[model samples]
Target chain A: MRRSALTSTLTFYLPLWAFLVLLLFPFYWMLVTAVRPNKELYNLSLNQLWTSHPTLQHFQKLLFATHFAPWLQNTMLIALGATVLALSCAVFAAYAVQRLRFRGSGVIGVAIFLSYLVPPVILFIPLARIINELGLWDRPAALILTYPTFLIPFATWLLMGYFKSIPVELEDCARIDGATRVQVLRHILLPLALPGILSALIFSFTLSWNEYLYALVFLSSTGSKTIPVGLATELITGDVFQWGPLMAGALLGSVPVALIYSFFVEHYVAGLTGALKE
Target chain B: MPSVQVTTAARVVRPAGLVGRVLENHHALGVMMVTPALLILAIFLAYPFGLGVWLSFTNATIGQAGRFVGLGNFRYLLGDSVFRVVVLNTTLYAAAAVVCKLVLGFLLALLVNREFRGKRIVRAIMLLPWIVPTSLSALVFYWIYDPTFSIITWALRRIGLLHGFINYLGDPNLARASLIAANIWRGIPFFAIGLLAGLQTVSPTLYEAAAIDGAGPWQKFWFVTWPVLLPLTVVVTVFSTIMTVGDFQLIWIITHGGPANATHLFGTLAYQRAIQGGFIGEGAAISAFVLPVLVGAVMVSFHYLRRE
Candidate 1:
């Protein structure tokens, strides 16, 4: 038994630890670098692993000096706007397609799925032109509107799976008991599908928060840029790299989505696998 | 006779007004419900796709419109050496990164599936790389790969494993490898967690049956785990392929297709040409090349989904 335990530890624990380190080292490095003093950051003699004197100067500078605060506000605004819009649309559409049994629902379902396959890479150029034509250039509303192009399909598909799992008998019983179709949806389907809807909300918010190319292409001004675009484009000036402030920005930028994911991880995993399982 | 009379009476007492009648009609209600989503998609997705294809056939610049040039953009791209290099780099990048992620991610799934202390926390931590914004994590990689004062270089030197600083992003070949490594790092959590979900669905009795039949570990996996994992693998693979192949953010942040544009994917190339260089037609054409591949992936996934 002891021998077997030793073998298992060697086989499992060691490799797992190595993988964890490799996967997480960057975040650790980001944290360390974010806190390290500029004096020690440039001083090659100091150990890179730990800091003798850790500081919050970088975070203070990021919040006070740069456009980081505005960028955060912009990112939050866009992500929330996009998530709300996408979830509302997706809920109605998924309900219609999954439960309504209307004509051509299958075709619509397939089309929505196909739309998810259309990556932003293919559409960003023309989208740039579209945004320009709509007079939304350098505006957060551009991302708010266009982000749903991707988000709706995903949210709709995931919610469809959730709606499918809920028993149709519940809706049928509600319909028979003097409930109108809209009333049935509001009272029965929506309540039971609340968990699914919450997951979709979280997923959409995180995705919108992480979105880059669209923000980069659509918003050009410093004040209008999102977190990803602001940090990447505005942080560095010419040849100078501000490692401390940049890492601080990265760490701060990741915190919101990371926090949300930690709370709803099970739902997040279920939503991910649920969509594919369908 | 009474039941038939009652049904006839109920039919006559139908929903009160036009609004109620419309809501009662499945076709009308469904159309109404779907209109908002379809409107957004039509205006944003479907229209832009067609516009993109049309723009690819013209010589349109950022400010000035151009007459249709038929196949001029495609013809020019076919002749351009940089475009050719981009095509190769994107293909190599996607193919290599997806394969590596599959292998390593599966290994990770297997490891994480075993019962362990702190398994929940470990699983949650594993997904951090994926949950973090790509651009942010890519910045961390950019710093890690810095020519001067790279922690990687410091650590390696301290271990006596190296004598000289490695220019990870300066050399063309090394830069490509660096970008792929970063992509795989960001991608593995997705596959590992996905496959782990699939792993949990397998029945323990199947493994017991295999063990009772004298099957070894490899044999049991081949006979039991492989079949169960195959469908999820195909789905996750196609999904990852679509995202990875059309990737822009990582490349944009880490290299910006730099060191003489050695790392330009279709997305980055399109941005460079159309958005930055003002050659909208050429950029549209560059991005349009990815459509056929996307269609092919969608078709494959659909076929698999339909089969099940």
Candidate 2:
């Protein structure tokens, strides 16, 4: 029985470990290429796993010699702006539905979520027109406006869950102390529910940063382009693909959020789980 | 002014605290708070949704108004060869990817659920792929599938698993599979983590009770875990289906629906038609095709995912 159990464990786990390695190897390979010297990278050596003389030259070129800086700046501006705007709007909407007994509240909640389910593909064409009519086409505000279509619904839903966890009695007691609704929200609810807000902000920021299709379609000028589209088109051209700098740019761009996850892993998980739950 | 008699009226007996007034009157404030959200939704979300349906009936192009050509685009799409293939591919891809994500994610969750040292770290690591940007990771895969120099191919050849070169992204069949594989890899994190959350909510005593009744591991899982997880699994499946069906980035970055239209899922196909091919009407029609399936999935899943 012991021997059979040992064999069963080996059969199940060993292959899974192998598969996991296979799954992760491409990402591992990317890091390898990012560090390897351009000369060594061209050689196709079996020992490409480790860099012989690892250098940060590729990263340097990405940062200094190319459009990487502008792209990074553009991404940061749009992402942060969108996150702040979306969260501000969503917090109020969420607070209303979760805490207050209002008319048509259920309908409002369901309507917001359904809007989130609407695919960007469904709305982009007409939305582009609306932006044009408003004289906002090719502008960053176009993205800001389009982003809340999905983000508000999600943020509202997410904040509602977090708000539910806050005890109502505390707010009631504070009410007896003569705190106005706005003051109570400012001093108590926002601080108490800060974790959920932060999570929502990060999610919204990363989403805007990573958005490709909208950036690709909407932004016309080189100055306005975000990182994903900007780098892909500029760095890669037919046969002479620029892997070293592209990977370097990618690595630098992703590191901030990756660090965010590593540091606040639990909140990140909680936020995601809560978001999905709704 | 003199007849009004400068009386203060005692300020109508103001509440003791600001909180008291707010607590007494939550509804009015709720309306005020929700107004901005409602207005934004009305302008950006609902209006555009209505516009989409309206535009489908018209021959609307980007930055230009075209005449209303009712049912014309749908007719053309019905006759288009590429659109047919896209519909087929999109359906197959969504079904296959969702199934693979569900099964693999469940298994991974089961494995990680076992007691082990550093389990929390493992769980966190498992979610890394999902947390990373999809386009960024897809770009990483693009390099891995490079024809001239690919680490994946090189490694496989070195291990004697592949003879010479493997153009994983260049070949049509292999290209679709490769995109699907990348998606499954990225998606497994969400599903596994979701299922793990569900698993934690199940009472351990139920499993212990089953064991006491002479039930084996499989029997315990079948009876207790499956029933408890069924609702969550359905919700995850629905979410995965919608996302996968609308997936464009992974395939777009990898193949651009290429090697002879083999990887043309609906989202990519729509972009290719409208943006690249300049068939605006046809693209809208193709995008509209997936709406029914998406709505159906949502309705069906809502039936199951709601609290009992």
True contacts kept of each: 0.78, 0.48
Report the C-alpha displacement of residue A258, candidate 2, in angstroms: 0.5
Q: By DockQ, who's the top model here?
A: 1
Off by over 4 Å in 1: B1-15
Taking the candidates in order, what DockQ does each have?
0.75, 0.54
Q: Which candidate number has the best lDDT?
A: 1
lDDT of each: 0.93, 0.79
Candidate 2 per-residue lDDT, tens place, A1-278, comes to 99988986786566457546755675687687888888888777646678779878888888887887888887888887778878888999999998886887888888887777777766666676687788877788888877877788888889998888999988886766766777778888999999999888777877787787777767778777778877776777787757888787767767777787888888878898787666
How much DockQ does model 2 earn? 0.54
lDDT of candidate 2 at residue A5, scale 0 to 100: 82
Q: Which CAPRI level is candidate 1?
A: medium
Pairs that collide, model 2 = A175-B19, A175-B20, A178-B17, A178-B18, A178-B19, A179-B18, A179-B19, A180-B18, A180-B19
